[model samples]
Target: MKNTYITHALFMAMAASAFAVPSLAQETNAVADQADSGGLEEIVVSARRRNETVQDTPVAVTAISPSQLEASAALTIGDLQGAAPNVLITSAGTGAAAANISIRGIAFADIEKSFDPAVGVNIDGVYIGTSTGQMLDFFDIGSIEILRGPQGTLFGRNTIAGVVNIKRSRPTGEFGGKFEASYGSYDQMGLRGVLNVPVIKDVLAAKFFAFHNESDGYYKTVGTGQRRGGSNNENFGASFLFTPGDRFESLLTFDKQVQDFDPILGPLSRTGDAFAGALPAEFVDGNNTDNVYRVVAPSQQMVGTYSSPGVTNEMNLDLDVVKLTSVTAYRESDDQLRQDYSTTGLYFADRDQQYKQFSQELRASGKLFDGFDYVAGVYYFNSRYHIDQFTSVFFGAPTHQDTTGWSKSYAGFVDFNWEVMDKVRISGGGRYTYDKKKLQTAFTDPSNAGASFTGDKNSECWKKFTPKLGVDYRPNEDLMVYGSWSRGYRSGGFNGRGLTPFASALPYDPETVDAYEIGLKSEFFDRRLTLNLAAFYSDYQDIQQTTTVSVPGVALPQTIVSNAANAKIKGLEADFSAKPMDRLTVRGSVGYTDSKFKGFIVNQPVATGPTTSISRSFDFSAVDMIYAPKITASINAEYKLPLGPGDLKLNAGYRYLSRYDQQISADPALYPTALASAPTDIITVAQNDPRLRSDAQNLLDASVSYVFSLDNGLNYRLTGYVRNLLDDRGTNTSFVASNFPVYWGFATAREPRVFGVQLGVDF
Candidate 1:
């Protein structure tokens, strides 16, 4: 049945190709006119493994220039939500480490890759495999391109939801550089530099970029004595270009970047309820990092432990957590988690996941003949991580938790593209990848702690055959029509050791996807208007998913991973721009999605699905949260002005994100937990239970900037911005239940109103 569908899709595409000859000629002529008008500049894209015009490519894509990114201050993917509708990357917690990226409604609910993310995050063609890893910051980027829908055919590794292509600045033949520096509230400080140097005349040129940022923690650490919510980072890179005036050239580039982060402060019983008596007066929110737990009866607790004259506390809590984390276990009589207890809480424990990565990719591309173009490339990478995660209770009390293993992966992929015809195009590419990983406990045998089990659960496997194909036709001088079909996949790995026997990792299978898309790219109204639209349908098989639940008699929680569901995603995206005046331009986009489970049966002992009637995509019930209504849209208008000194440009914009849950959690019955005994009066929910669903909130953000140039060929820019302009508080809630409700808190309030200003100069 699937083969028949592919055949029909190809036949129709072939027919379209057959009739697009005249349109091709017309498009070429129209392109010539646009060149004269300076509106349709050549857009070089490698979506198919080779460079081509945006209109000549068959994929649905949106490209934002460096100026656009700077104007919006889109420092990360999540900030790109209102900047581009089809691309919605959001965060549940604080900082650049806890964001979830969703493309066309395909989001990765599991942060640990037991289940893969539909969309993949790539920086300079290097795959950022995990969901948390995707939360990294962006620096020294020349441009950003977001391809909506499935993208399996060309890129290797991920192509489930879509692709985010980040293109960094390369070496320039001319010697020049730009520098930006800023300081703001929260003791914020940042500096960045981009330099292009002429190394060997026209033969070799070199480019260098550097960034450093430091800030104080936003949330108080209280008695813990550790600062949380602050960002400490340092990044730098160098690229050497060797053109040597030949068809064969090589570009050698490398970068070293790290974010030394302060972990997010622990659970808040409620969102902004403000702690008075419920929280001890000596608790000293935000500055104390004492890990020793001490309970006080109203009579014995003293006032001002730090400032008071004579206050003898029972426990001194000598904490040295930057180096070690203490632990505590309680053998309670009842089930641990209860719905009524939290209302909705933030369980601040389980805080490990520090990432460090190194990657390399070498690509070469050139025009072949009168109607042919091609490209080929090799990729390699290595990453090591040392993480310390823990979940603890208030008053500096360490709860039952586990310190897990160090994780790692190594992989490679080869890709190529061919422009087979003048008017018609065909692209083919593939990748061979191998990934190995392990997870074990760092703590000794603790009678009442989860994740304290020993031995590494090691799994390693090879992934082969990831290919892509595409076709584009110019229906007329004004429109470029196209269609594409491709394949993409994510490597599989082991489940953490905390899971029960039957639910262990075992032999998990790699998940694969096939995507089909049709679209139009065009420019009209005499170079004043530009528009792009696309529709896509994708089929996913053996999709990976995970459920974290606790066993009744055990102190630790269980994590189950398997290929338990299949899914189908369908969506449409539109991008439009209008430049009415010479110095003024307006741009906006919208994305619509419809997705659901196709074939799913939870806890199946084997890989096969049971016989069942087929209906709409949403009929299958094994899915935890694939179906998402993520309606995102935005608009920005910039008007260039002529002020005193030189060319003065004024820019301002607004962005909005519709309500959508970050993850579709599993429900109790389908993915159930073992018997429970705890102290809380509430009921214990399963790990994957969707009922602990986090709330969805809308957000709005805006910014403005100005540019000024001097008489000596030098330029300067100043920008002021505000995030969460409306202060629309977004709630982030997660369900982390052990044998009981050991930890509880709501995700932090959405980022507050952040006001910032920057100054830059080019030399």
Candidate 2:
């Protein structure tokens, strides 16, 4: 069956290419005959530390233009999932500001500062140090680039999977501005505006941007009669450009973001009726029918609030033969989460965290000789992270934990490209990274208030050398094929959520990946059609896995972090686009990934007697990797109609993903709800728990827009759009734990149907 699926996918790709070639040829001929020549627009990107056309760059990347983002109404970073193949972005926990971004089936879901993200997120060449505040709300003009596979050489560390690069629009030395507003379902409202001023004409300029949006949630709390997942967010930023000379320029920017919202934690099933009176009657009943998109909660706890403020300064100097640049940045965030965990209103958890980061990078890029170009850089990063919070069940039996950590990283890298022959080029690069971190933790339980539950300070360091080598051969101006081998690395750290002293003292090791890929990029029929295909195989070592396990006598589950095992992942990805006619455009992509573990084992707590307990290991070598859907595909189409006074545009996109698991552990005991009998001393449920699995998903989005010219150098655009048009049930996060003698698991739901209308004017 697997072979059959692969064969079918390959056939589909070939068929699509075959069909596109003929259409493109016909269109080119017709255009030439009619003298109405207009080819596909070229996209410029900075994926490899240099500005180049997407088709000319030797990397697998997807660039989303500002116009496309506006048309799709991508309010946040998480809405970029279906835009690229083998990429998935989901919210972590219930906070809209926490993003779990995965590319090629690799992601780090642990919400700890010690652990760096596998996929790197950056803005204007400045890296975002933590994932807690990575889910930035979208606003203003600019572009977004998604780079697939490891980017360890040019992008530095923590890019083992890929990178998401966001570049904001800068002052263009023109006096112009724009304003936008939108209204949507559930009383949603959005407003955004930007202004640019020429302080000194060609010498200096200033730009300011701001955005605000809010919505009443779709789900309502049964008892409080209030919306459970409502959201409110706002952001503003300013930038100043100083061009003192013809060869030197500097840009300074400052921004602040604020988010206040409640997350939707839907319940699948409830048992024991422990808080029957505290929760809604229907929610307490295990037999009650489930509504995937709705919540039945009584607590309706306070909102989770997150705030971030940051500043960056970048300077560039152009010499006769080389360009020198420097980027310095600082960012800080405060996050507070207060929510009911059990959905039954039986247990509420609260957490507060503060984070600060500073980084600087110096780089130089230019040509060394004829047909030879190079880029080199040095980077320094430092960060301070703290967490202090208390958890209370039934508003009593409070448990408190206070922790703080600091990290420092330094790296130097150099990349060189040489044209060995007329149609072939060789590229090689390497980076040496040194990482160090120190942490201190304290835990206090009122039930055991008199006992000592703290750990001493701990520190660790790691050093690694990662390299990349590739060869690109261009047989013709319209076609290129490339192959490369690369090494990726990510440093490890302590688990911030560990409940026990022993667990807090133990830390995981750094992970490494060796990847090999071969790809082909081609353009046909006067560049009216473009197609790119890539196949990759990766070997992952010392994979860090996170899981929650019950202790023998502890009142709460402790988070355990360990080096799980080795794994192998192989995949194929294809992206294609064709402008069949001047008024119509078609785009599609398909991704297939197969990931499996080897010699995998997980630790579980077992009770040998009423007073004795021990840890046992379970083998799960055959288990599949979490969040790795075997098949994912998407298709998009857009058409435009020119009228006497205006232009009408219609757009639609559809995406599909296969079933996949949402957790790292594969313990058999985590599948069943309870023990088999009262006298049973040992119970093992089974692997591949159905409760932790998410069904396949299909999502459709469509939009329509009208645009026309107005008087006095003003233009207006109006658009209406719908997301999740089919209202498919989609799960984002899954949780499982042994809460006493019973094993229960819960899943979180994604957004439902959303329809809105937007209006904008440029003057």
Candidate 3:
């Protein structure tokens, strides 16, 4: 029966592909099937601002196709991590404010206010300007390509770890459209559409894509007047493709995305909830049910309860991106997220960030000789109106807002790929990037010893010329090995959110890294097995370490930001997939990462009391920031069974993350805030200890889907899936403190298991 289903699926997939072998995917990869031994085309990508096959290219890149995404119902960046090994996507709390994304285990540390990330993100050749941590909102993207190592050669600034490129679908000269509506448990509803129209025969084409999704949150926000936590999204995009006999080609695109999410207030107990991750003894009956924040009156002592959430967040995130590509491009990007994040249920202590960016890139790329591909381009990125604000909590719970920071960058580069030999691929690239940042703003009230946050408003600039060398060896159609070396750097700036003048006045040095990598990309068993394996070592200088500062008089507990330090990282990554038989497919990936600071010296910012000596308050610089265990393993399988109406698919997947503290330097001497007014020597926490081990449990997700094809061009599918089948306790805790004697705070856990059912039909 399974064989029958496989036979039918192959026939139908081929038939649906116009009865053609879809050499499109194969042609793009440019490798012959192991069994066929015939040459195939290489995958084409815009990794270097030009189109070339991933196999033929001379850099380390991993690409995930649309079908692969569909198979897993990947809607967020976290889902893509499964396909792209070593890419970690986690959240600080939940919602649109702090989505932490790290590539190559470079992102296992806590985030600071307005601090940049090691990994940068780009969409359609335009760079995203800010890292507010929780801003992962996207839909209808065609593909995602991750450049493993430093992308400073072609992509500049903050590409120390790598880069993530999101390529959206464009218009085709055909009249076709797809619409799907799905309904799942907890009132989950998802609707997505894709439409294409031919505006002119061979001159122009128009395409539109849109998606809407909503779901009940996994945890119930107890005592909230409204539904505690849930998810909602709306996204739309339009694109135009123009071509005149291939001599002149152009693409214009516009995209907009918005999201709404209500995160769960707190975490579950050590033993997880009976039905998954829930706060037991909370929200039992309808009205007046006892919840976490329920309060009871003395007169009614039997059941006293208050309906106030311990933590809550409500936010609106909107992103607008427009791009015009001819021989050049004018790219505009605006990402705005207004969040009311809080720990006290009330909307009074929200933190907010505003990101506005615009960029222009002009380039000319094409094939010169039969085997030579070249490109030269100029780039400019400007980010303004990067606003950061705090709720009343900053001012002894006093609200404050400031907008004195923005960044601008200019760069130019030339890159080319040459097939020197059929078996050897070489790529040479260089980029000269110069950036400047000027901050001019004032805070209403700093911490206890500060009045106006202004003198720290200084300006600094940097210039770097990064070059890259890469080579790919393809001994045969089924195997390839690649090597690359490159340099990456991130600029320096001030932390404006600090309260004391000294805390905000600190100066930081530029962070830089030189990386070397060797990798093997191969396919075995006639297109049935695909493997990507790599090992790398990086030497980092002036690394940007996130540390906290204590403001005795200010309202908030602490402030986090970047400081200079030396570090090193070494790791290995492997992704494997095998279709041993025609009907079964198995894919898995494992990553081993070791990142640590070599000479990290923390800067203590808390001022000693008026009665204390200067050395006691400001003369401490200790080594902090340590090893990250790294993300370990993930596996997914899909099996087909012959069913009465059609075929039934049994899909199961599991992902494991190693145990390690999300943030290090948690001891009294290092992460000292929790020990208010204590000596810096008292802090003792490190990066790889048990107190901070957030070794997330293996999340097992499985789904069963049945599909039926109608006589017309219509298909229907019904799927039932369980996320976190074991109802594991996913943790999200971190230690944040200033000096040893001040304050150290921790956050809540992750969302619990969710059982859902999805029904969909496409015509």
Candidate 4:
């Protein structure tokens, strides 16, 4: 079946290319001239760390421009969900400002500073180390590029999946500014402004921007009628561009972001009636319902705060034949939150964390010979963090834990592209990376006077050499075919949620993937139509799996990370854009993924008595991978009409996603041995947990805008937009606790339908 699918996909792609040539020949000269005058807009990107048209780049990537963002009403990073193929981005339920990003079935959703992300998010050439503060608001953005598959050679560590490269707008050396304001549903309000000045015309320039947005949450408490989920976000930044001479240039940037919000944790326990006997009627009255917005409230309100400040400096020098570049960056973050899990106030946690990081990179790129070019670089990074947490559960007294960790990494990489033939090119590169990490932890229990202990400090290191090879064939200016093989690696780390000394000090092994891909890029009818397709297969090894497990003599379950599985993943992607008429444009994409576990072996813990437990080996290959949907597709269209001294534009989009699982340990066999057998209700509820699966979803959005200019040399635009037009609200994230009395689960709701109006002016 898999072979047939691949064959059909390739045949269709070739057939489309063949069909395009004849169609172009049949067009009349008048139609050809019309197409030449009004065709699809050209897109230029920096996917390879250099400027090139999207059709010329060999890598499989999607570039979103500022105009596209405005048409889609994309205010935050999470709004980029359906803009690319085989990519999923969402908010982490546990953290207010965190992003849970997945690419090609590889994902990481936890909010731990110690663990690294599979997908890399790079902002202006600086890689973000942690998931915290990654879901940034969009303000003065130049461009966004999503690269699919492994990019290990050029983009170094933790790029096992791919990279989301974001570039901000630079100083234009002009005296100009822009301002905007908005109001929306749920009492939402937003304001944004940007200013650019030529400090020393032709020599230096400065740019500044600020953004603020707030909303009165959509969800409401059952009895108190209070808002459950809402947020107030702000961002401020400045940039300075200096060009002392023709040979040297420098850009310095500084930014700060703040997020204050309340998260909604709805109870969806299957055994709600069982809890009714012990808790008040209001607490369990509406539990286990399909609606996600109305939930029981705890005695104390849930609140969270996240703040981050960062600075970056990039300098470039041109020596005629060689261009040298250096980038220096530093960032710091602070996060604090108080969470209520049980809804009845029986289970809750309070956490505070601080993190700091510094990095330096130097590289040189230039033409080596007549038909050859090379790029080489060396990078160094250092980061440290501390976390303090307090927890209270139904079966045990309150406990406090403190953790501290640090990591250092060094890497050297080089890449080259050589034109060996008239119409052929070969490219290859390699990277060598060395990483070291250290961790220390302490735990205390107030109920047990002598249960306090400090874990032994531990350290570990890992090293790897990854390589890539590719060949490209350009038959003509409008046609290209490419194939490549690459290897990617992710570093190892200790579990930050470990409750015991043994688990806290043990480190997991690294994860790696070997990927093979083939793709085609083409344009037809005088650049009026564009199409691209890609097929890829990967071998994943030493997979890192995080799971909750019961421990002897501990009242609550503990979380552990281990290298426990091997897998195979394969996928197909297609992207197309067309300008059928003078004022109409259409764009669409389709993505399909097939991922399966080859071997999954875990050490399952079985309770032998009230205070003792034993471990046994279990095979869980029957379980499905999380967030690996079989099919995802989207289509968007825009139409422009000339009005009285202005242009009126209308836009609409639709997205579809297949059902998939959201939890790792959802197999029935593991539940029997992993949880206690008493209360019979616990076993029944575990078998039929609704939080384990996410249903299929279909989303729709629309927007309308009008633009005009006045005699006073001013430009104005007014826009009205609606997202989630059909109001298809589904669970964004859901999970069942692993601790004792596992009869309940928690879930977070996706945003409901939102409508707003915005006005902008430029002078």
- Sequence-dependent TM-score of model 3: 0.78
- In the order shown, the candidates' Cα RMSDs to the true structure are 16.6, 9.8, 10.1, 10.4
lDDT of each: 0.51, 0.75, 0.56, 0.78
Clash tally, candidates in order: 47, 0, 55, 0
Q: Write candidate 2's Cα lDDT for 396-498 as tens digits.
A: 6778889988899999999888999999999989889999888888988887664338888888889999999999999999999999998989887787777
Ranking by lDDT: 4, 2, 3, 1
Alpha-carbon RMSD, candidate 1: 16.6
lDDT for 236 in candidate 4 is 75
Instruction: Point out where model 2 deviates above 4 Å.
Output: 1-37, 223-225, 269-290, 450-452, 607-614, 667-688, 738-744
Model 4 TM-score, all chains together? 0.91
**Runs off by more than 4 Å, candidate 4:** 1-37, 272-290, 395-397, 449-451, 607-616, 667-690, 739-743
Relative to the unseen true structure, what is the Cα RMSD of model 3? 10.1
How would you encode candidate 3's per-residue C-alpha lDDT over 366-400 as one tens digit per residue? Answer: 67777787666677777654455554431244556
What would the TM-scores of all predictions be?
0.72, 0.90, 0.78, 0.91
